[model samples]
Target: MTGWTAEDMPSLTDRTVVVTGANSGLGLEGSEAFARKGATVVMACRSVERGESAAAEIRGAVPDATLDVRECDLGDLANVEAFADGLHEDYDAVDVLCNNAGVMAIPRSETADGFETQFGVNHLGHFALTGHLLDLLRAADGESRIVTQSSGAHEMGEIDFDDLQHERSYGKWDAYGQSKLANLLFAYELQRRLGNHGWDNVISVTCHPGYADTDLQFKGPREMGSTLRTAFMGIANAVFAQSAEQGALPMLYAATADDVIGGEYVGPGGLFDMRGAPEFQQSNEASRDEATAERLWAVSTDLTGVEYDFESA
Candidate 1:
């Protein structure tokens, strides 16, 4: 895997893949790659109209692409449940789930559930979604994968159990980091739980797009009405970041590479992991703390009211 690219991905004909935040950036790139490899991609976005437009663009490129556009607003638990329910009604099994949608460094805000926007949508939303779909993923005919998108920002994160929602105080970057770190914690802990429950057919993996040029970098500035900051970020993206398609290599690799094992983290392989091919990487120590993961899992279940039915395994 020294120089792996999406072209190296194995054929996924007959497979069903779900991608959240598939309207643009890495999500759209990954969805297109999966479609090119003969997989049926379910584009899960917050807006059905935008999703359909993205699907149209994909079909314009990959004429025979099998695609579905569905509404999945991670900021709302009810919306996520409806999305998962629709999937369950339509498909018996899902070959892959890419927890790729997220918000970053925006002005302080709360989700529909009253949880911090970053923590709620980035971590808890995906957490509940995974729980809702675990059974269908396990029912897949072959090995199935759940790829959670994390970030390098996680290194600076510390899970503040006392202020998980940043209720008392809020720092946009801090909240974003915590949520990304939670992604890693959840991914690793899910793999462990799957192992203990004897569910060998499903594996959980984590990946990060190392400093890719995506709309995410500009959203915060735009939201804050800071044209200067937005322009600065645009300059940074142009000068330092890799293309979204190139940045999506790691998650695609984690989802499709035969050698990828459960509980592994994948990211860019270049200097400082900012660009290049996909490769295995290691996260900070806090991200792997089992005790923290367990507590977070319990709190997440309590908050989202979604429980993993591991007993069935």
Candidate 2:
């Protein structure tokens, strides 16, 4: 994917896709790109109003776009379950699932479900949702793909087994890093298990938008436009990031490329994978550790109470 372009992407004519956090940024742009390829897109977000607005934006761009807006608050597992159930009822099967919605570098806060906000929303919620849709994915009969959005921050993260929640102590950056790392691990392990279970028909992969200028890094009111915050964001955006449309390229490639393999990762092809053309990328050494992958999967099942037959995941 070193020099991949959307024009080179195969048509997604019959694909039905769902993208989390589709109200804006990379997710929104990704949905737009997919719709342009003739796929039916679903924008899964926390706000129906915001999602519908984004849908309107996409439809304005692609007059014949087929799109749907569904409310999904990832911080709450109850909502995830409902979202999955709603999806199952609304569509016979889904072709692609982009686990892209995420909270980044946020201060300590608890989700409605009482889990740490970043970990819950970015990792566990996706974990549960993936499990919830595993059967439908397999039923798609080799036409399905799952893309988990990760980040370069994963390189700095180590899964703290003693405290997955950072219950006793919490730092915003580290928690966010840990969550992103878990995303990679989850994708890798899912691919491996699917292979072991003889379900090679399903594909699982991970990707990250090289430093994209998105609202992912700013959420709270106080940090919205502070001078220092603005300066830092500007520096990062100018020096290392691409536009959100560019940021979503690796994921778009992973989702639509004909040759993308399960368990592989894709990212920007540039300095530190921060910006440039889309291409295959690698995560930190910890991301591929088989032992850690196994334990993390078990821990995820325990925490989310969403168990899949290990032989069929």
Q: Mind giving the per-residue lDDT tens digits that candidate 2 earns over 60-163?
A: 99999999999899998999999999988978778899999999877788888788898999999999999998877776735699999999999888899898
Candidate 2: residue pairs that collide: none
Model 1 is weakest, by summed lDDT over 10 consecutive residues, at 304-313
- Against the reference, the lDDT scores of all candidates come to 0.96, 0.87
Candidate 1, 7-79: lDDT as tens digits: 9999999999999999999999999999999999999999999889999999999999999999999999999
Q: Judge candidate 1 at residue 284 and give its lDDT.
A: 96
Highest TM-score: give the candidate number: 1
Model 2: CA > 4 A from native: 220-227, 310-313
